[model samples]
Target chain A: EPEVTQTPSHQVTQMGQEVILRCVPISNHLYFYWYRQILGQKVEFLVSFYNNEISEKSEIFDDQFSVERPDGSNFTLKIRSTKLEDSAMYFCASRLQGSEGYTFGSGTRLTVV
Target chain B: QQPVQSPQAVILREGEDAVINCSSSKALYSVHWYRQKHGEAPVFLMILLKGGEQKGHDKISASFNEKKQQSSLYLTASQLSYSGTYFCGTGPSGGSYIPTFGRGTSLIVHP
Candidate 1:
């Protein structure tokens, strides 16, 4: 089975620093999404991307956050001036055109000190 | 908007059965079920697109209401491996594929 891959399984950064989380979605999947889980809390939607542009975004995705498919295979989320509250497990997910089911990456645990 | 999941947590013994319910205030286009183990990504279980549809995988099954506003997941003859958090994601009828997930239902099955 094909899998979505996320890099830097765990990252710890200074509160005010900028960090980027990377992901490689399924090869044939067209819709990409970013979500976050705060510890044992609910999974929160961040943004959705398609056709090299953002299709939808939640209030959680503010000006300090951005997502990009820098290359055909790489999807990245960049957060600037990170705050302590930014610490969470960030997940990347993708699905094919028909939207049968979503495949999620293992997730990157981001911690701001 | 987010869906509401019932019985935030459950404890079951091997060979027992359990049902987790998810409800939404808005009409739904599809319902997706996923299971997540500790410190791991959520694993997709099933997706129900049509209203009044029911599907199962192994001993696990799920059903979507005719109104498309609610869904229920059933676990039969549970095993130890069935222990994890179950999430129900809902997508209101539209062109977008983004799904809003419910909080989650924690299941602990012991042998």
Candidate 2:
């Protein structure tokens, strides 16, 4: 089975610093998404990307958060200024259609201190 | 709005069966199911679209009731490997919509 690859499986950064989480979705998948799971919490949607632009985003994806498909293959989530509350496991997912199930990446465990 | 999952957690022995239910206040076009092991990302289990469809695979199955805005996941003859947190995600329409998930139902199977 094809896997969504995520880099820096675990990342530790100082509070107030910047962080970028990277992901490479399935080659043919058309829709990509970013989600976060706080420790012992429900998974929360961050943003969805399609057709090279953002299709939808949640309130959690505020002014400090931005997503981009820098190239044709790489999808990235950038946090302008990290906060202690920003620590969580960030997962990148992709699917062939809007109504289909998602293939989630292994996730990047972000830790801010 | 976020969906609701019943039996926040369940404990079962191998060969036993279990059921987890998810309900939403708003009508839904599709329902998605996922399972997440501790410290791992959520893995896709299955999806049930409108028309009150039901699907199953490998002793695991799910049902979607679009009119009632509810979905259920059933695990039959469970195995230890079936232990995980199950989540149900719902989409408002068939279009490109962001799916939201419930808090999740934790299942622990023992031998």
Candidate 3:
């Protein structure tokens, strides 16, 4: 079975530095999404992308956050300036349709110090 | 809004049954079920759309009640492998593309 894969399984960055988390969603999936989970917290939706554009985003996805599907298979999330709170397990997910359940990547653990 | 999951944690013995509930404050278009083992990605189990649909996988089953904005996952005759954190992701009505997941219910099944 094809699965969503993410690069840099774990990352450590300085508090004010920029960070990019990369993901390659399921080959045939269309809708792509980014979610984050703070240690011991529920997974929170960050943004949803379709047609190479952002469909929806949460409050947490503020000015610092951006997503790009630079290529056919690569989906990337960029944080312009990281904050301590940005440290979390960032997950990339994709689904064929709204009715289908999403397949999530193993996740990229971002650590800011 | 985030869905509320009941019974933060549960412990069950092999061959036992368990039910986890998820309730949302807003109207929902669909509810998705997923299971995540420690340190691993979440695996999709099933999705229940509006109009009161029920979907199941093997011995795991789930039901979505749009009228009440709630969903429930049923694990019957559970095995030790069923131990994990189960999440209910809710897609609100009005074409909201992002699904908000509940806090998750942690289940520990023992042999």
Candidate 4:
């Protein structure tokens, strides 16, 4: 089965530093998404991307955060200023056209010190 | 709003049957089921759209009750592989594609 690949399985950064997380979604998927799971909390949606632009974003996706489909297959999430609370597992997911199911990447564990 | 799931956790022996439930306060356009092992990505199992439909995969199946805004996932003849956390993601009946996930139901299947 094809899989969505996320780089940097684990990353630790200073609280005020900027960080960029990368992902390669499934080749045929049309929709891409970024979600986060804080320790001991439910997974929360951050943003959804389609047609090379953002389709929808939650309140958690603020000015400090941005997403880009920099290349045909690569999707990225950049956090301008990481906070202590930003330490969490960030996941990348993709959906094929006309499909309700989403395939998620293994996730990158972001830890801000 | 996020959905609520019943039975925070469950432990069963092989071949036992178990059911996990999810309910939402808002009307649903679809309900999705996924299972995740510890420290791993969630694996999509099935999706139940509106119209109170039921979907199945292997011995695992789920039913949606559109009127009640609830869904149930049933697992039969459970195997060791079934030991994981199950989550129900609810999508509101609108253009919102982001589905809110429940807290999750943990299942432990013992020998």
Per-prediction DockQ? 0.82, 0.82, 0.88, 0.85
**Backbone atom clashes (below 3 Å) for every candidate:** 0, 0, 0, 0
Looking at model 2, residue B55 earns an lDDT score of: 97
The numbered model that scores best in DockQ is 3
Give lDDT tens digits, candidate 1, residues A1-113: 89999999999999999999999999989999999999999888899899999989988999999999988999999998899999999999998864577899999999999
Q: lDDT order of candidates, best first?
A: 2, 4, 1, 3
DockQ rank order: 3, 4, 2, 1
lDDT (Cα) of model 2: 0.93
TM-score of each: 0.96, 0.97, 0.96, 0.97
Candidate 1: segments with Cα more than 4 A from true spot: B93-97
For model 4, residues A1-113, the per-residue Cα lDDT tens digits are 99999999999999999999999999999999999999767888899999999989998999999999987999999999999999999999999963478899999999999
Best model per lDDT: 2
Q: Per-residue CA lDDT of candidate 3, range A1-113, in tens? A: 89999989999999999999999998889999999999878888899998889999988999999999998999999999999999999999999986788999999999999
Give lDDT tens digits, candidate 2, residues A68-87. 99889999999999999999
- Every candidate's lDDT: 0.92, 0.93, 0.91, 0.93
TM-score of the A chain in candidate 2? 0.99
DockQ of 3: 0.88
The fraction of reference A/B contacts recovered in model 1 reads 0.90
- Model 1, span B26-88: residue lDDT tens: 888789999999999999999998899999989999999957489999999999999999999
lDDT for residue A65 in candidate 1, whole number 0-100: 97
